[model samples]
Target: MRRPNIVWISTHDINPDLGCYAGVWPGAEYARTPNLDALARRGVRFDNAFAAAPICAPARSAIITGCFPTSIGTMHMRSKAVPPPDVRLLPEIMRAAGYYCTNNWFTDFQVDLPEIVFDDCSPEAHWRNRPTAETPFFAMFHGMATHESQLYLDDDAFAAATAHVAEADRHLPADAPLPPYYPDDEVFRTAWARYSDLITEMDHWVGGLVAELEEDGVLENTIVVFWSDHGKGMPRAKRWPNEAGLREPLIVSWPDRLPTGAGVTDLVHTMDLAPTMLALAGLEVPEAMQGVALFGGEGALRPQPNEFTFGGRDRQGEADDRSRTVRDPRFRYIRNYFPDKPAMIHTEYPDRLPTWAAFRRLASDECQQRARGELPSAMTAAQRAVVAQSKPSEELYDILADPHETVNLAAEPAHLDDLERLRAALDSWILEYGDLGAIPESDLEERWRPGGRRPATEPPEVALEAGVLSLRATTPGTLLGWTPDEPASAAEPSSFQSEIGLPAPDGRSWNLYTGPVAVGQPIWVKAWRIGFAPSDDIPVRVPVPV
Candidate 1:
C-alpha cells in the first residue's frame, strides 16, 4: 500500500552466538532473542550476510553509503581524519528521494553527513515517533547498551553479569574439536561466560526495540535488518582477521516483500547496503558504491548477481596495514600486505592492538579448545618468532570447512587451486577498489577524555605563533613547556585552554598546544605531559609557511 519503510538496526562487536542466531545469545541457557526470532519467522532470514568490513566505523560507513570501507579510504573504524563531504551516503540519497532519515545519537564524526542523518548518543537516542504514511522513512538505530568490557554497569548488574557459570553450558559438544591453535583454560572459559551474558542482555534489548516497532503498527511494512559491526571485542576476537573477528550474524526480516521465513546462504558484504538501498528506492546507484542491494520489495531485484564486496584491515597500528578480503558465497580470500604480524600477536602482545581501540577482556570459554592443545614443540621457536613478526603476506581459507579459520590452508599443497584463484580475485579487488594502504596511520581520530598529564620521553620541535606556540603535545593533554629555553619540561598548565579538541593518536605526532607564543617566534615546543605516555618529542618549526 505504501512505499515500505526501512529500518536498520546495527550493534557493535557481537558474534552470532545469540539465541535468535545461534541459540542462547551464546549465553548459559539464554538464547534470549524471542523478539528477533519472532521477527525472523515472518520474513526472509539471511544466513550468510556479512559486513563489508567486519568492523564498526567501516561497517557503518558501508551500510550508510553501500560501499566498501577501503574503496572510500574508510577501511578501519575511527580512521578518517575527518568525515568526507563528497561521498553520497544512503541517508542523503533517501533524503533527496523524499524519505525522512534519522538515527539515535553519537555516530562517529567520520561518518557524519550533514542534513541527512543525525544522532544524539544519549540513552534516549532510539525514541520512536515516526509520522504515519505522510512520507516514507529510512531510520537507522544502534544498540550501545551492551558494549564490550561493560564495566560501567551498576553494582547489582555488574555482580550478576560477572557471576559464575554452570558446567553444562560452558563446554562445546565432544565432537566439536578445539581449533588447531588456541588455549583451553579456565581463563578463556570464564571470559567466554561473561561474554555470553552480555549478549543475552543485548538480545533482551533488541526484543524491546522489536516490541516497540510492532506496537507502532509499522513492523510488518518495514524492511528490517539486524547486524553487528564485528565479532566480540575480545583479545583476538575483535581486531582479528580470524573467523571469530570477521564472522558476524546478519538476519534480514522483511514480511511479504521478496521471500519470507527462508534462509538465503548467499554471502553479502556491508558496503552493498548503500547500493542496495539506492537500487531499491528506484535511484541509480553511483559507480562509487562498490556494493549492490540484494533484498527489497518492488524494483529492488536484479536480473543477475552483483560482483563481490570487500573488507579492510586498517584499524589502530594497522594503519600502515594493507589488507584486503574478497568473498563470494563459497570462499573468503585475504591478502595482508603486512603479514609479518599475525592477528594473534595482538593477544600475546596487547600493545600490538591499537592504543585507540580497547577490546573486551579475556573472560570467555571460547578459548577452551585452544587452551587444551599441546604446545607445538617442532616449531615453537619459529612460531614464537612469527608471532613476534607480522603474518605471512598471503592467506587462503576454505571457509566452509574451517569456518573459524584457525588453520592457514594458504600453504597446504592440496588447496593451491582455490588459494591462487582466491588470491587473484582478492588482488583484483584491491586494484578495482583503489584501496590505498592505510592513509591516516598517524592521523588518529578516536576521541578519549583527556585525563591529567602522564610522564614524558621523546621531544620534538614545537612552534609558537600569535603569542600562542602551537604546543602540539603529541596527541592532546594540558599545556607543557618551559619559559624560553627550558629543557623540555612536563607541566600541566592550569590556565591552558584549546580553541579546538585534540586529534586522536595514530601512534604518531601530537598537536600539543602552548599558551600564547610571540608572532613569528622560533619556539621549540615538545610533547611532555600526555594522557598515556610521554611520547618522543616531535619538533615542529611553526610560523607555518604561508
Candidate 2:
C-alpha cells in the first residue's frame, strides 16, 4: 500500500483509564475497558499523552490542526472558538494532497456555520460527497456516547450496569483512591464507579468499530488511531491543568506497518495527532502544526521530542477564564489566572446526573474543610485572604511525590528556581507559537471583537396581545410577515407582522415570523437566515389553563 488509509476515532470528554495507563491508583486496573485494551495489545500504547487543551472544542481543534489551541483563538471551548475564514483546516489540507477525507457527524468548526467548512452537509451529515480521491483515504468518526451529557443514558442501561454494582460500589467503589484534591468518602467512590460504567459502555462501541473495519477488510492496511478530545468532567481534572483533566488515552494500531505491542513513553501532546496522522498518510505536515510526528525522532541533531507532554486549561470548569496548567512526566504546575475565585465553585456540580453528585459531594467537602488536609498553606491563605485574588497566580507540584497535586512549591523557597524557569519556558513557547493569548492583556478587547457570528441583520423578538403582534427592525433590515413554524411570505404581510426581504437563496437558513398565537393554543417559532447561520429552531410551548 502506498501509504495506508487513516481512520481517526475520537471520543469526547474522557481520560486514559485502560490496561495501559496502570491506574493512577491500583483499583483503576478494573476500570472496564476491554476494547481499548485490545487495541493497546495490538499496537503501540502511549502512556504519557497530553491534550493541547483540557476541554473540548479547543482540544479537538488543536488535534486536527497540529497547533496549540490558543494559536487559533479557540483557547476556550465554544465561547471563543471563532477562527477567521482564512484559516486552513486539516481536512482541506488532505483535499489538496488528493486524499478522500471524510468525517461522520461532526466538525465543531462547522457546527455553527456549515458552509464555511463543509462543501456540503448533505448526502450525509458531514462527509458524503467529498472532494478528493487520487490518493489514500482519511475519515474521522466521533464517539458521541462518551460525552457527559449522555451519562444520563436512558434509565435502562443504568439499571443493567449498576445491577451488579456492589452496595459498597453503589455507595462508591471500594474505598476508592481519593484523588489528592478530594477527601476519601462515599460520594467520590460511588460517582467514580458510575463514571467507569460509562467508560465501559464507550469501550464496547470502540471494540465494535474495530470489528467492523476488520469485516470491511480494511483492518490490516489502515492506521487506526484512538484518542479523547480531552479529560473527564471531574472538578479539578475537567477544567483545571491537573492530570486527572489533561492526560489523554492515545492508542495507535497498524498491525503490518507500525510496531505492534510496543509502548512509547516519549511525551507526546494530543495536538500532534493531526500532523502525525498526516505523516502516516504520506502528506506533508503544514508549517502551522506546532507538534512533531510521533514516528519522527525528537527535534535536535539527535532530535527527540521534549520530555514533557503539554496542554493548558481555559475557562471550562466551575467558572471560566480563571486557571491554567503545564505538565511534564513528574510535575504539574498550575497558574491561577484568576486567584480571587474559589477553586471549588458550586457550578462544577453536574446537578442533573448521579455521577455529578458523587464527585461533587467530595470536591465540595474538600473546599469546605481546607484546614485538615495536606493542602499547601498558601492555597489556604489565598482561599481565606484573597477576595478573588489574582496574585500569587503561579503554582508548581512534583506529581511523583503528590499525584493528587496537593503541594504548592511556587512559594516554597527551594523550588523558586525551578518555578521561574518553567514560567519563562511557558511564556517563550506561548509567544513563539503566535498564540492569540500572547497578545498583551491590554490589547485583547480591541483585537477580538469584530469576529462574532451574531448575524449581519439582527433577528427581531416578538410579543403579542389580543390580535396584534409588535414588530421591531434594524434601520436597514425590514420587518417581514408571520412565520410561526416556517418562513413568512412577503405577499401575506397583512395576515401577520413579518419583514419582507429578498428571499434567501440558500435552503437551510431561516427567516423570523410571529402572529396571533392564541393564548390557549400550541405554537413554536423558527428563526431563519437564508444564506447565513443554520436555521435556529426554538420551540415555545404555551398552553392555556382551563
Candidate 3:
C-alpha cells in the first residue's frame, strides 16, 4: 500500500470521557461526543496512552520530538532548553521525505524552532495548500476551545464560548461527576459542566474537519489521529504527574488499511507519535528519537513493546516541584523530589479558577474546625489530601484496585515488591535520561543561554551556478529555509528593504531547504538553529547562463 496522508487533530485538556470508551473510563455518561464515537468505531482506540508530562508545553515537546521532556531539557513548563545536538522535529523529518507538513498555528513545543520546519504553520494552514494532488500531507489541527482557560472564564464569557453547544448536549452543574479527591461544591460542579460543554464543542469541530477530508476525497487515503494534550484541566489533574493528569485519549482511523472497531490496551506514550508518523510515511525513524513506532506494518522500525510508561513534572507557573512516575499495567509508583512541598501548592494561573477559590475556602474552614477540637471533620481522607501540608517522598497505587489513585500504598508491606520494582524502573530511566530538572532553573538558564542572551543563527550563504541554487549556514547546526516566490513588496522594496537591499523574512511561505533547487527566479533564504533567532533574510539573485 502507498504511504498514507496523516492528519492529527489535537485538543486541549480532555480525558477519555467519550461515548466509545463508556465502560472503560469515568464521565462517559456526561460526554456528548457522537463525532468522536463514530470515528472511534472506524478505528482503533488506545485505552492506556499517557503523555510525558501533564502540562501542555512539556507534553507537546515530547510529542513533537519523540523524546521525553526530561531527555530534551523541556520538562519544566515554558522552559527553553537547548535541544541535544542531534535532535530534529517530527515535521522536519516528514518534510525531508516529501510530505507536505502543516500545523494549524498552536506550537507550544517549549523549545524554539526553525521557521521552515513545517511547510505551513499558521491558522490558515491546511493539507489543501500542498503543491500537488499527488503529494502525501501531514496536517495538524489544534483545538483550543477545550483548553483550561475555558473552565475559568466568568459566567458571561463561558456562556459565549459554549453557545454553540446544543441544549441537549449541554451539561448541568449538578450533573457533573465529582472526583472523590475534590470537594463536592457548586464551584467544582460548575467548572466540570463547563469542561463538558467545551469537550462537546471540540467534538463538533473535529467532525467538521473530518468531513472536510472526506469531501476532498482523501479520507480513505489518510490516517486520522485524534488526541488530547493531557487529561482534564481541573485541579490536581492539569499539572500533577498522576494518571488523571497525564493519561490522554488516542484514536487512529484509516478506513482503507487498518482493522476497524478495535481497542488496544497496550501501554503507549504520546512521545511515540513522532516515530509512528514517520513509520507510516515510509521513512526511517531517527535513532535520536527515544520513542519507538507503535504501528507501521511489517519491516517498520518498531521496538519491543514497552512494559512501563513514565511521566515527569517540574516548575509550572508559580509552583516549583519535581516528581517522576512509572506505571505498569496494574501499579503506578511516584517519586517526589520535593517531599516538603504540598501537592496543591499555589500557582498564579490556576489560582484564578473559581474551583480553586472554593477549595481554599473549604480547606480554611476545615483547619479552623480541627483547631476548635471538632471530632470527625466532615472532609473525607481523599478530600483532606488536597490540603495536606506536605507529600510523602514516595507513593504507590494499585491502579486496578483504585482507578482514581486516591489511596497510596507506598508504606504497605504487602505491596512492597511492586513499589520497589517500579521505584527501580523509574530510577533507571532517570539515570539513563539525565533529568535537567534536577538542575536549578537559574543554573540551567545560564548553561543554555550564556549571559542570558538568546542566540541567533548566522545568515545563510547562497550560490547560484548553472541555473541551480545552493545555500549554506556558518552555524554548525542551523536549519535552512528558502522560498522561490517573490517578496510581497519585491516590486517596490519597503524603507527597511531599501536600506538593506533585502526583503524582510516572509515566514509563511518558507520550505525546509533539503537540497539544491533549479533556479529560474529570485529566492529568499534564512537560517535558524533551534532555540535561536532566525537569520535575517538574504536575497539570492539568479545568475544568467554564460
* Residues 1-546 of candidate 2: C-alpha lDDT, one tens digit per residue: 376777777887777766566744334565767788889888877767888776776777777667776766767555434344435467656644555566664555411322322223222432224344334666777766667665555668776644533443232367455454543455556556666776776777788778877876767877889998777765556655667777788988887667777767667888777777777777778776778888752211112465555566665533556455666666666776666665544453355455445544444555666757655332233223212224357878887787656667888988877787777767666667656654542244335444433343344465655534544443232322233444333233221111111122234322223234443333333332222333343344444445
Q: Residue-wise lDDT of candidate 1 within 100-123, one digit each (tens)?
A: 666654354233222212222223
Cα lDDT, model 2, residue 505: 24
Better of 2 and 3 by TM-score: 3
Task: Report the error of model 1 at residue 468, Å.
Answer: 47
Best by TM-score: 3
The lDDT of each candidate is 0.53, 0.58, 0.83
**Ten contiguous residues minimizing lDDT sum, candidate 3:** 496-505
Worst 10 contiguous positions by lDDT, candidate 1:
493-502
Clashes of 3: 0
Instruction: Output the lDDT of residue 390, model 3.
Output: 97
Where does the lowest 10-residue lDDT sum fall in candidate 2? 495-504
Clash number by candidate, in order? 65, 21, 0
TM-score of 2: 0.70
Question: What digit string (tens of lDDT, one per residue) describes model 3 on residues 329-446?
Answer: 8998999999999988889878767777777777888878889988636568888787687988999988888988999999999988998899899989989888888889899888
Ranking by TM-score: 3, 2, 1
